[model samples]
Target: MQSLNEILLQKKIKEIRFKAIASIVCGFLSIIPYLGVLFALASWILFFIVLYDLKIYGGTKNLFKNLFIVAGIGFFGILINVSVLFVILKPRIDIFGGLYFNEDNAFLAIGTFCVLFYITLALIFPFFKAFYYEIARVTKQKYFINAFWAYFIGICTLPLFGLGAIGVLIGYILKLVAWIKFKEFDEQEIVNLEERLAKEQKKVFDLKWIKITMASFIILNLLVLVFIIFQYFISFVGLDYNAELYIRRTLFYIATILALLSVFLFCKKLKTYKLFIYFLIWQGLSVFCDYILFTPPSIIMSKTAYGSLIIVLNLCCIILAFLFFKSLVQITKEKLFYLVFIFFTCNGFVAICYTSLLITLNHLVFEKLFLVGIILFQVAYFISFLIFWLKLKGQKSVKIC
Candidate 1:
């Protein structure tokens, strides 16, 4: 049989590798033209995760300490940049009839930003130098040495414009290779805390995300149900069509986000990163269908054809949702999965009912009955959440915080 240390070490290595790839993608995506700032912010979150996993792998509390500070500063810089763009620029410019940014104010902002940038750059370079050295030491990867020099030379030549991009590009490519070359270490390397490693693997669950998503579903669904019934009796003025369409579209948007966050928590515990990614794509496609069903088409198509399309689409949605929950059951090996599954399935049906009944302009009495069904299905949401909480309480290893 394989040794316990061997198993644990492999798991750690796999996790680090997965996180490294995610970080790399986020890092590159941070450079994309319009999306850069958004991804830059996201990249820092992944940066923390990458460093966190590496810290665990190396079994040291103080590993990559300086890099952590650099990450924090980088994140802070993005926020400050955004603040300057929004708060300092546009509002003042509008107040001054677009003349507030006359040369002096622009110069002051640029000068202040430069002073801060150079000071932080001086500190950031050294942190990265130390960070690369430590990675080389721990992983026995000398390519990190080359990575450091490439990155160092790149930043130093940023004043030379495109010349710097060459070095920075090489640096990132080398760093990616270095992560791929990372080796698995023995579990005894955790300062001989193999027993603790076993408990650490018991899994940590974040109930906060769960509760938030559940609350969003309950509140949004109940509101939509109420609005559907209200619109039946009291038509909205200045509204050409049902308001339910706009609100339901909003629900899909919020639910898309909440659902992803909730599923991410599940994936985090299950270590199913790839699975979460697939679900993200599926969710995206589902939302794309939302626009298709809610908005009038640009091209020619019969109403019968469109309605038939929606039925097929929603049916497919229910099936995908079914498989998602079913997979959770299989992976968790928890019978309690079914309750959550039922909650999600009922929510899916509620969505179908509300959208269809609103589109068809059902009688007021029919809408009232649909509202009653919604309130009853909400009970399943509470029951599933209760089961989740009670299950966590049963586990001695889980820290609620």
Candidate 2:
């Protein structure tokens, strides 16, 4: 028996090594020009390798069960890329843009799409892994169905990817802690506390930590966005003005530092209520800084280049503020009624600023088009949110009454 166990473990280790090598090879193959077909083959090979690796571990049944989930996600992604290519390229007669495509622009589009897709997949992969592990741990029958439900959480939570990344990171930490806890439980005389303790411990992962981590990421990404906007305006609008760009760049750095410090404080694991209070304080100060520091000078230095910066700043603040409000609802367990009002008000502020800025710049069509998209998103989200709120309220009221 001991010899057999040793052989099994060696085989598993070898399988893991092979899978890792195959994954790396496939990653490299994906970047070669005119090799997308080969890349797809490598991706399929990588998928099988992953499955084989899982089987070599204790997760053979899990790989079998959740195969559909793995296939569905990957296939959908490839399908969307294909759809986009067909839609964009089919109309243009330029071979680079069409059936015989050969332009740098076409290659650029393909490369950019591939990079973005992979980055998105890399970010969300952990959630899928966690869900698979949980399904195997928690259920004995209908493994596929259970795994699908868990995976559905990831799918449904797409809009919250910015926030979900925080949850997923916490989930990774919990995974390590969970393994330790599982070992501890296995050694204990008492076992009923396992699930209870697992859940109770997660309270430490409450909303405050999530908010701070998310805010830090958003701020950093915003800085990158600002730089890209600066470059675009400079390139296209002939706004080769260096002083304006320098000021905006300096402000972006300042915001990034503040965001980092905010994240550090949250990492210290302060009490949730205290952290919430600090969040309010920081945001209030941010508003002050925005009005006093960024706004006045941005206006006084008004030019086409600066206009883009103002628009970007306004968009970032509005979106971040909306997310903060959403987090408050989730944390405070408040009714969604209040959130609707808040969302509208927040977006109204964004629209007003955007319109006023565009009007000041005399850009009518651009402002109108942007406002249309904003209004549509808000309206659609509002209606969907109302339905959800009503359903939740009914469920609660029935339980109480």
Candidate 3:
């Protein structure tokens, strides 16, 4: 009994020390804003050393397996993020002014890439760790790497024409299957830990409440439908100036709905749900913030200043969207990775051209260009819908046949 008491006291002391060290480290990391990349690198190095020591001391096979799993997740995250980044930034090598793929620019780009990498690890590592505990002896990090590598190669094999798009779909399916197969975790560790803990972790958001609230909120937003109807009426009646109010009101109402969705999404604990939610949120927030912060008079200071601010904000939004997707891939829905990547990439490209498109479309000739762009967007949407339908049909046929 005395020996058991001593052991318990020692364990308590160790836990206290561990928590204190963790708190200090977290405090220091939080203090540095842009230094998160450096901070994460340091944390990872420290983690490896500590884990190595722990593995040696315990001689636990599970520890080594967990190390592999985490490393694999890190690799998967880095590959997916960097690949999408390459697609987005590759086209702007010449036109973006400064960084023409020079060494300094390259270093900056690589360093910036770490921003996404670190953000992903920070958010998902705990989940992976928790998952590691749950899966017990069956969990191995190599499985995740192998799964990701296979998916990467498949994507690389995508055909250059529209078949490339089909390749993306197949690649997505392959990745999804791999993850599902590899997600074989044992809940024994979690159950055992729960027996020792004071309390179990509580669910952050209730799904039932979420559903009910969203449905009600969506119903309330039908007033925006009325505003949109009023806009057509004003436009048809030749009240050109009144039509501007209708348009503004219509957009504002849409923005409000988007903002609400974003808030609900932001509150969500899952990344995939947050991804689409944040996308709408950013769009809504940008429009709403711009309306409030930059009236025409405020933006008339200098053309460069206005342009620079908008560019900076748009870039910030793109980064946020990436972070949102990273969270989604790691957390809520891993299957949505390719779709999320393509959607964000397409939207980011649109944002980059949005202001220019607006400026040019003020001319009569550009009206045709605007119409063409709208038509193209519609066509792309229809094509995507058709592909989705075909894939669904294929899935059903496979299940049946």
- Using lDDT, give the best candidate's number: 1
Residues 1-401, candidate 3: write the lDDT tens digits.
55663464345334333532443364357346433433343344334433442332222345556556767777888788877666545634465555543353565566566676566556555655543343223333244344344434443343234344554445344433433444322333323432333222232333444444344433333443344445533344544545655565555554444334433433432422445456544554455445533356254555445545566676776677677656645653344444644654564455446655554444444444444453344344334422332232111111000
Worst 10-residue lDDT window for candidate 2 reads 392-401
Please state every model's RMSD to the true fold in angstroms.
Answer: 6.8, 19.5, 21.2
Expressed as tens digits, the lDDT of each residue in 1-401 for candidate 1 is 87876677677777677677667777888666533543454455566666766665665455467766878877786567656644444445465456454454666666556565566577677677777787677666788799889988886666565597889889988888888888754334556555445556676544666556656655665565555556655656645455566776677566556656655665655556655655555575576565676566436366556655666666676677567656756665676767766775676677576656554653444665665675566566555754553354222344211
* Most TM-score-accurate candidate: 1
- From the highest lDDT down, the ranking of the candidates is 1, 2, 3
Which residue pairs clash in candidate 1?
Answer: none
lDDT by residue (tens digit), candidate 2, 1-401? 55654464445445444544555455556566433333444445445655543443433445554566656767787677777765555544664545454354576666656665665466547556654554345322233334344444444444454554444444434333332222111112123433433443444333344344445444554554455455543354544556556655555545444443443333323323333334433444344434443344455675555555545555555555566545546644765645564655555566657646764665565655555555554654455443433333211111000
Alpha-carbon shift of residue 331 in model 2 (angstroms): 7.5
Worst 10 residues of 1 by lDDT: 392-401
Where does model 1 exceed 4 Å of error? 1-15, 22-50, 63-68, 78-112, 148-168, 184-262, 265-282, 286-313, 330-394, 397-401
Q: What is the TM-score ranking, best to worst?
A: 1, 3, 2
* Model 2 regions more than 4 Å off: 1-137, 140-192, 195-212, 228-233, 236-401
Q: How far is candidate 3 from the true structure (C-alpha RMSD, Å)?
A: 21.2
